[model samples]
Target: MATTFQKCKTDEKNKAYPCASTRCKHPWTVRYREPGGRSGRQREKSFPTKTEAVDHGVKMENDKREGTYIDPKRGAVPLKVYAEKWIGRQHMATNTEGTYERAFRLHIYPALGSRLLSAIRTDDIEQLGRDMTTAGLSANSADAYLTPLRSVCKAAVVNGDIGRNPFIGAKLPKLPNKAVDETQLPTGQQIQDMADEFRPEWALSIWLMAGLGLRTGEMLGLRIGDFQEDHVRVSRQITRGKAGQGPVIGPLKHRRVGDWRKIPLPTNLRDAVRAHVAAYGTGPDGALFKTLTGTLVAASDYATHFKKVTKLLGFEWSPHDLRHWFASTALSNGLPLLDVSRWLGHKSINETADTYGHLTPDSTGRAVKVMDVAITQHRAGLVLDTAA
Candidate 1:
């Protein structure tokens, strides 16, 4: 028997194989025997130039043997599908999964969902990042959009769906390394004024953030049961999700075994928390903070309300500024770096010192004084130094 290759027709009646060429693309028809007793007809893409079409066909055949080929008929899976699968494979905690899912839905999918996985190039990713930057997304946020995409590309490579990960050498925009000055610690007067402007609940929220260094999510995630004899346990956080997905409760961010701090709860704050719990506790699962409906309070809810309060009070601080306030206050009050680190739940004193060391003017002055005293003592012990 002779193997025959026949040119396919452009029209449906002639019914030949379709061409894979983007321009002048058509299909070619072939009848071939299977390894079994069955015979079948396969249609391949037809190219205007036979050689070009044959070349692509040959390469595709070779890829089939090398196990590096994906059927065009299957099409390139969209990034969204791969992302969902990848997230499922991740051993992330509940909160982490929630956060990643939110980032994917809100950021990555909107940017790159329509493109085929194989069609994604470094240029595409770079441009996507640029577009995000141009659209007023922060550098950090733009970089965040890349995280899910990178994961998807890697998965494609592992599955042999694509030859190389395009994001491998992609250049992302540089994020600002400087701490945000506008959200930095508030002045004493500013804190007092801001506190005075809020209702008891909102004021306490601000106080915990600035006064206790609790993350906003952590503060909202707290329950009455988490309070101990003297300290509040930081074991979980509240995260918001997109669409109909409700807020998820998960473990503390960057949590470690010894990550929890046991700062003494102020008497007033403790009393307020107890009172609020007594008055509004929705039972065991009842969140410490909630809307009028008794549901988990969204970060947006508190942030928007806090902003209004701050505006009314003429304070220029953000909710996170409370953390800075706590750190700065501790350092300025002569708290040792190690103690401050423990109080702030920092992994190390070095981290604490790096962030608030400049606030320790008194410590610096004391170091100078100790050096001066040592020099004075050395001079006093010198015999006839002036008679020399």
Candidate 2:
């Protein structure tokens, strides 16, 4: 597209004012043509002076040649408004949407909401990180807050609303190691005791979690129809949406809607499930575990019951600790790492290995013993050969 610079004439006087008029706020207008059908439409903007207008028009031409021109007004939208539109466009799960919305409300909006997309700077991002740290947020929590912000900034860059992401290279708190510290995990005995102590009505669910490594969400979302004679299918999960909205049922994490995993049922667990079913009919939603009111069980309610049971048993652990117990027990019992990973519904084998690999029993002593036996056999064969 072609570009030009022109002087703006005073309408009443019908006279073109010279550049550098202290009184004339908008003395010059830069004119350019945009790409359009048949003799593209002309677009223009006013500047403070003719020289400045000409420079801007030439820069626009150069930018057009390089395919990097972004209209200055494109990023005039505030961060909060742009973030809201961006969030709306995403086809995320209900819980994920709530998480992003919560992040925006609690982290991004308070610090950068009113700032225009184009006006945000790297220092502003750094300052925000510092503020979050000063407010006693962990590195992981701060990064969680920054995640949606980074995604939105990248989208803005892609939409040509901003030249680049200000937070791209900004300093953030260093995340700690990702390994699951087994020291915090509950022992198998503790798990068994907790399960044994649970009210008969909730005992089967507790046993399933401790044995199968299923997430709390997956366990609560289970329905009677999802279970077969030999195995149970994991197709959906439940999660709490923003604070007061309560638990929401949705597809399993890292899976498409309607996708599922089938886990082989243990004989004892199947019997327990059968007994539980006989005592308590399916919930209104056909859920295997339900409250007295026949609604699908809420995780918080389960936790309350679990805490009460553990306290009575003289121990304490989150429901998720049951899954940890399963992973450690399975790995110790010679189950293949890959199978354990699938049973846990992990997105990748590496994730499973990173979390539980260290928990696998050490084999250095066994390795030495095996090597010693091999060496002894080799010497015995040499001695027999020589004697023969």
**In model 2, how large is the Cα lDDT of residue 111?**
94
**Residues 28-133, candidate 2, lDDT per residue (tens digit)?**
7777764443485567877777778888788777776777877767899999999999988999988787788888889899999999989999999989888998
Supply every candidate's count of residue pairs whose N, Cα or C atoms clash at under 3 angstroms.
13, 0
Specify the highest-TM-score model's number. 2
**Root-mean-square deviation (CA) per prediction:** 7.9, 6.0
* Full-model lDDT for every candidate: 0.68, 0.82
Report the C-alpha displacement of residue 379, candidate 1, in angstroms.
18
Tens digit of per-residue lDDT, candidate 1, span 1-388: 1122444434445454454445544433322222223342343554555566566666665665666756553437787776777777787766666667777777678878777777778998898889889999989888876776787788778876777889888888997743334345587677767777876555656766766688788888877777776777777777775456676666666673234556767677778777777665643385677777667877777888888988886666677788877877777777776776776666676776666776765566788999989888888646557766
